[model samples]
Target chain A: MRNIFIIFKRELKSYFNNPLAYVLIIIFSLLSMGLTFVIGDFLKMNDASLTSFFFFHPWIYMIFGPAIGMRLWSEEHRMGTTELLLTMPISAWQAIVGKFLAACVVLAAALLSTISIVFTVYYLGKPDGQMIVSGYIGSFLVGASSIAITCAISAFTRNQISCLLVAVAVCFVLVLAGFPRVTEFLRPNFPALADIGNSVSFWWHQSEMARGIIRLQSPVYLLSLIGFSLYLTGVIIRGKRS
Target chain B: MIDIANLTKHFGPKVAVDNLSLSVQKGQVLGFLGPNGAGKSTAMRMITGYLPPTSGSIVIGGIDMLEDPNAAKALIGYLPESAPLYQDMTVEGFLSFAAELRGLDGQRRRDAVGNALATCFLEGVRRQSIDTLSKGYRHRTCLAQAIIHDPEVLILDEPTDGLDPNQKDVVRNLIRHMGKTKAIIFSTHILEEVEACCTRAVIIDRGKVVADGTPDHLKRHAARAGSVTVRFQNAPGGLRQDLEKLKYGARLEAVETAGSTLSAVVYPKTKADASNLSAEIYELARSRNLALSELHEEPGRLDEMFRELTSQNKV
Candidate 1:
């Protein structure tokens, strides 16, 4: 536990030291808010809830999560610091968990930066505070899940650009799995395929939480996705030494 | 404090490190020497627990590395080849991070970082990011990270690889000083470093141990180790024939003749004859009324010994 915290502190400090993190946060904030206002038609919806605001989160997180997580293990391997860090007195699992949490915190910060939208909803009318909190929670989980997948992919390669490309490709498929058009097409010809798509889709679970319906299955699915990806990261790192 | 036995690593069909075994006790510095692709770095990685061996065991400070790596690793300070470090961190920040990872904290962590900075002469760049430092400074910063916890065992791979001459001298002196209390194993391609800091030297070839002994003992294996060189002025005509016919002299070659001055070298018949060959030549020069300018037995050269041991054509 102590070793994990030490690694986490160093990783977080490194993120802040680089200008990439600030740029990512600013871009994520502008894109999410801009999409919410322009495309979602925030004022014309005539609803006090932040349904329009939470709608664009999965698409925005698909790009920004990999942007932040691409450097986690890829930089370590590129700079040859994997040997230095692995030879230290900490276990590989500790290092993986530490870096994963640090990147998740960066994602969390990007998610939190859109809290002003919640205030805008409250000022216009009496918005459901519990629903707004649930929406933020659900959005943060989607971002965390995206970062975790990217972190796992980053462990497989030393090139950050390759890591980002592969991760975005994977996340794009996940986002498309349960899109309305795809699901509508699959539901008629292949009902079973549509069910599997919804089961693994990031949009499916996130939209459930956005509606303030905290079903046990949605949080459980997202948490397990995060857990499985991190476990895969540990496996890849251990495989490198052998 | 480090004992490795039957260590081997095979990458696909090619064997990297093969059945290598060596040990280092407290107060002993073992110099690891090998030609390129001889598996020196691979063996060090196995010992440091960065890479697991295919079939072997590494015991550091009496702790088995494979079974309990964290405990074993805690006692070791390793500097990998080329001195890899976090380039984005300040020197002090990196050292402190290393100290913290080693379980030091608060005042102890501060003291460890300070001592490492002073020891490696990194005080000038304490606040500077590692990317801005020169190669020599970057190398020393990694070295400082290795020694931050003052570990009981130190494994350094080519610690002075890219340093300038003065920096190399300082690093060599530091290694010599630190070897007194810690078990140290460092790999280097430079032959002089064996004599400078190592108490024992091991040379490997094709992933196998070829020579293991004191530097002087290994040097004695050189082809020309026991030969005697003699210089004379106004020497007699049959000097080469006379020197060749001596009882202990195996062969004699006249090296140079400029004007009335001549220099010749006599090879000994056996290792035991080297000590007496020089005296025999001096006595011969005295009796023949020859002016003997210089006569001395040649010590073996480490570079020659290294080349001979690691040469690919050796049977």
Candidate 2:
């Protein structure tokens, strides 16, 4: 555990030391705010609830999460620091978890910085505080899943571009799996296939939490996905050592 | 403190390191000498527990590397080839990170980092980011990271490679000082490093140990051991045959003539008696009225011996 935190602190500090972190925060803020007002009809509804703001989260996270997480292992592998890190006394699991937590720290900050949107909705009218908290929680979980997937894919290859492309493609499929149109299309021919897609989809659970319905299954599902991806990342790292 | 037996590594069908064995006790600096692609780096990697061998065993301080690598790895400090480093980190921050990874804590960690920085001459650029430093400073920073914990076993792969002469001397002197307490093994293609710093050397070729001995012992294995060259100004027709038929003729292994000079190498026939035929050869030349221009015995040449030993072709 001590070793994990040591790696965690170094990785987290490195994120802030580079210009990419600030650039990512700006891009995420712009996309999230833009999708809510320009496309979700924020002003026309005049609603105090941030339903439209939270609606674009799954898509917004898919882009920003991978962009931030692509460098987690790819940079280390490309620079050959993977050799140094693995040969250290720390276990492979510790390195993977520490790097994952570091990415989560950056993701949390990027998500939390858009609280101005929450302030705007609050000032205009009375918004449901319960739903806002639940929405933030759901967004954090979704962002974590995306980052975990990115980290895992990054371990297989050293190129950041390849990691980003594969992560975006994989996450895109997960997002599309739960889309009502896709599930609706599948149900006519294959009900069992549609059920599986609905069960595995990030949007399927994220939307429920966005509606302020905090089910136990939702957190378990997202947590399991993160755990599995992190485990696979550890396997890839240990494979590289031999 | 390090023992490797029958260490072999194969990359698919190709063998990178053949069956080889060696051991290094405490207070010994073993210079790993070989040409490029001779498996020096691969052997060091296996010893450090970074790469698992195909079929072998590595025991570091009595800890089986294959069984419990972490304990064995904890006792070693390795500087890999090229000295890879985190470029964004400052020298002080990097050393502290290394110390923490090595399990040092609190005041001890601070002191270890400080000591490494001072030892590697990194105090002046301790606050500078690694990417911003010059190559020499960067190399020094990498060296500092390796020794931050001061482990008992040090495996350095080409520690002074790519450095200028002054930097090379500093690193070599540092290695010599540290070798007093640690079991150190450093690989290099430079022959002079073996003589200057290493207490013993193992010359490897193609994946095997071709020769292992002290510098002086290996140098004495040269083909020209106790050989003498006699350059004559006025030649005598039967000088070569006359020199071969002298009283110590049995000691003369071979005699060859180049231009006006006749050189002969003597391999002592008996262990205790190495006949000095130089005096006898001069007397014979004087009796025969031949003018002697140069007559001197040559010590063995290490470079020539090294070439001759490693260049043997495999059947």
Candidate with maximal lDDT: 1
Docking quality tier of model 2 = medium
TM-score for all models, in order of appearance: 0.98, 0.92
lDDT of 2 by residue, B43-122 (tens): 99899888889999999999999899889889999898888899999999999999999999999999999999999999
* DockQ of every candidate structure: 0.90, 0.74
Q: Candidate 2, clashing residue pairs? A: none
Off by over 4 Å in 1: B258-260
Model 1 per-residue lDDT at A216: 89
Per-residue lDDT of candidate 1, residues B198-231 (tens digit): 9999999989999999998888889989999999
Best by DockQ: 1
Give candidate 2 regions above 4 Å deviation: B230-239, B246-297
- As a whole number from 0 to 100, the lDDT of residue B39 in candidate 2 is 92
A18-127: candidate 2 lDDT, tens digit per residue: 99998898888888889999999987998888888888888887788799899999999898888888778778889999999999999888887888999999899999
Worst 10 residues of 2 chain A by lDDT: A233-242
